[model samples]
Target: MRRRLSFFACLGVAVERVMTDNGGCYRSREFNAALAAEGVRHIYTRPYSPWQNGKVERMNRTLALEWQYGRAWDSEAGKASTLPAFIEHYNWGRPHSACGGAAAHAAHRRRKQPFGTQQLVIHAFRKSSISM
Candidate 1:
């Protein structure tokens, strides 16, 4: 997970914490050490607690509905071209059910906080790295 997170670093995003289920593999000494080395807090969700995993689950469902299976992409480049638009809509246009019906960016603005962790993840869809 630590090495995988380096990809986010390449996108000018700093990952501070990660929440995952209490899987045995994630609880291993090596995994803990890796997260510690990266200065990332490893947050383990409660066992059998689906609510704790809601945010990630919701994002996956949204991506599937809005991006993956929603349209036909003529080519890789075609998909790439359209992704940013969808991401823009997702962050700035659509009202999220979980954010009191506020668009994500609007909600973030109201709170005066940085972008949501999940929203920043749209950078992963880019074909090129963006330097900070």
Candidate 2:
């Protein structure tokens, strides 16, 4: 838990909330307390509702396809040995459509901008620039 918090700090991310399935570890008092100390909130998905956690579910499916079965390994040890490289490739090199075509690592480093074309259009709409 300390390591996870430290990782987020190193990434300059103040994790406001996390959504996960109601797993035993996630529901544990110790885990919840640690997150609370960091001012983070936990949200649980309803049972058997993968769509409720759509992004994570899609990522899990992606990993199975791209890493687990993407290549033939001589042994579990071989796969484990190459896991770090695969992770690096996935985070830093691969462009994710869900991340607006940015690599995951790059996307994670970005902060939300207050102003954008969408925000500008919405501001105009609120001022009645266009009518229904």
Worst 10 residues of 1 by lDDT: 123-132
- For model 1, what is the C-alpha lDDT against the true structure? 0.67
**Stretches > 4 Å off in candidate 2:** 105-132
Candidate 2: residue 11 Cα off by (Å): 2.6
> Cα RMSD (Å) per model?
7.5, 13.9
TM-score of each: 0.52, 0.71
Tens-digit lDDT string for candidate 1 (1-132): 755687668755788877776766668798789889999888877899958877655665687777866787677667666766886787679998868999876877788765434444322221122111
> After superposition, which runs of candidate 1 have C-alpha atoms over 4 Å from their true positions?
1-16, 21-34, 45-51, 112-132
Return model 1's CA RMSD, one decimal. Answer: 7.5
Instruction: Tell me the deviation in Å of residue 96 in model 2.
Output: 0.7
State in Å the error of residue 43, model 1. 2.4
Best by TM-score: 2
